[model samples]
Target: MQPETIKTQQPDLTGAAPAARLHQVAAFAGLSADQTAHLAQPSNIERSIADHMIENMVTTLAIPVGVATGLLVDGQEVMVPLAIEETSIVSFVTDSARKCRPAGGITTSMSGTVMIAQIQLVHVPDPYRTRTLILERRDEIGALCDACDPTLLRMGGGFRDIEVRIIDTAAGPMVVLHLLIDTRDAMGANTVNTMAEAVAPRLKEWTGAQPLLRILSNLADRRLARAHATWRPADIGGEAVRDAIVLAYRFADADPYRATTNNKGIMNGISAVVLATGNDTRAVEAGAHAYAARSGRYRSLSQWEVDAEGNLCGSIELPMAVGLVGGATRTHPTARVLLAITGAKTAEGLARIIAAVGLVQNFGALHALTTDGIQKGHMARHASNVAIDAGAVGEDVAQVAQEMIARRSINVETAKAILAERQSQRAD
Candidate 1:
């Protein structure tokens, strides 16, 4: 399929064009006038809802929501709405991807998503003895587990393998059964958890190993997605800059403390999309960090190297267990809209896009660290926000923001002062 194109997302201010013309485009399709207005300005309000057999429950929380503009994935133009609060996140990723767009953006590939369901079996007289029984009846047990979610089987996904581990822990010797499940497109949590519960009773009877916990493990090492991108040396010129990036990457690669911050840069973008979709961002984050240290040493989630051709090549590999069928994927209207814009039908496809976002975002940070420094480009974008917060009106917003950034004081107070000075000059 051809890639999408990026277009200016500014609302139609002029009353000249036919309204239907805008609706025909994919960008404006499937949205009501009211929803369109809501997108133009999002709100975070406290609301109450009744749960089954439960009375009035009120929740107070701030939704860190915003929009990610200028997204061009595979020639498709999408204006993504992100609900995230972490500073410098959305800006860094979007800016990096824009610079790499000329090189055909970033291309991503993913492995077939296979999430592991850990069914803990404990209090057994002999875990080693139980291991033999489970393995011997692997297919039979796997079928019993798969039968719980027939819909998944009909969709060509279900329990694929069964393995048992005899772990000697501080508490005692225990057997941990692993159900390697193929979740297909959806996040495999509910499916695997259900399967685990179904097999628990059978497992207890067969091996006499009591089932303790039947839950899905967030350490999604099996379901992995990766993305890669390359930037020409000419695009990011000078030997000094190249060396600086390589050095910075090495610092991150070698030290866990540095690597954590560097990886956080990548997650800033990935988590935004994940949050927008109503997926579990915390699970994704946990899986990523755990996967990074899977080899016994904590390191950078991304790898950076200067290729023989002198072009900068970057890649990232992370555990991404995202889904499409369950949770807020269908519940929230905005998530539904964002999913449609990406043209992703399956959960794995979304994982690939998330991987690509991380790659582009990390590149953004490394590029900044190597060249003019991380604050320059980020502060420039933030200046406008400060200006607005300082109550700069209309055209003066941009003008005053530019002056604040130029003076190296891109803060709300500086912006306010600049706006007042500009107004006084105009009055004089």
Candidate 2:
């Protein structure tokens, strides 16, 4: 028997009622026809056929990835697509965005893309000789690299600067070449790596420096993006709220133990979208934490300050290297759909949206910790899963889950209790 060939389909938006178009995902099932059409617009429908190898390599499982709605980014309403299974992440970001809505939402900006390429030079007769040789030949070397990617140059993007370093490592004394390239709108990793590899032969001929590693580095400190928001004192008014928020930031900043977890809260939303859309989450994480410790200390990813007017101001700056085209973004079916949803023009535009989502996520955690407590809200959403696991069906799943939470017990034990109680009453 031939297995079904699952062709990717969009909710048909051609004159269909709005609620009728949200096809695959259950989360969007309740949306109106207008909402479905808006979501299913041609701009948001991205499709790609998976090569058999690609399907075999990455993962065989398809996890539920949903868009976090009610987001107002840069005064624009957005539905953020997040590809993660963890409970509370989507809800947390949505809650945070709602809190920030009155403050005009989040504003973000990115440094124009500057990517790094690393070249390792080994077995040099004299380390200083190779360093001087490379520096002297920089313009020639840069020109050679620039020629390899003419399209980038035509678009006002190409090699901008060259740097060299001599390091004494456990292996031996080695010289390194650093190529700084302005990538413009795309994630410059592939661009920079190609240019670096193109120059390796020339570099060998000049100084006899054996190039070992010709690759792009993820430490995109030069390509940083930042987002900031402010909350009124009246909005956070009570002493407990103020103290708890400040304490949360301080704890993360003061202790590396806490900072990683704190940053994880921010990445919960950021990474989900990154993974769903086929962006390199590992590279982004590596660059982010490395940049965080560039000052020689592992500190918090965000800073919190109280203004003279007593408003709580928060800001975050981190290395974010993301692209809208090429690599996984173009290859994956859903990743393409995610970019279509945003209608973003450039990679930097997407980065700003990502930063905004991170800020919103942080706000959600801080707000919960400062007020009602994180577990209270998180457990509420988690209850449904517990009910389902406990064998509750359809509507009864939510009912049993809510009842369990209302009684301050939302565990397997509680779920079982509710199930038994309901079954007994029905039997009577």
Best by TM-score: 2
What would the per-residue lDDT of candidate 2 be over residues 48-67, giving only the tens digit for each residue?
Answer: 34444265443245556666
Extract clashing residue pairs from model 2. 18-32, 18-33, 18-34, 19-32, 19-33
Pairs of residues clashing in candidate 1? 3-74, 3-75, 3-76, 4-74, 4-75, 4-76, 5-75, 5-76, 5-77, 65-83
State the TM-score for model 1: 0.84
Give the count of colliding residue pairs in each prediction: 10, 5
Error of 1 at 41 (Å): 6.5
lDDT of every predicted structure (CA atoms): 0.76, 0.77
C-alpha TM-scores of all predictions: 0.84, 0.85
lDDT of 2: 0.77
lDDT of 1 by residue, 1-428 (tens): 32233344433322323343234333444566655544444442224222321355455344655444444555544444456765567666666666665555677778778888888887888878789999999989878877888888999988878778888988899899999999987887888998888888988888888899999888887888888877666656756666777788899989999999998888888888898876889999999999889889888999878888776778889999999887667655556665764557789878888888888778778888877887888788778878989998888988988899789999988988899899899999
Instruction: Indicate the residue-level lDDT of 112 in model 1.
Output: 75
TM-score of 2: 0.85
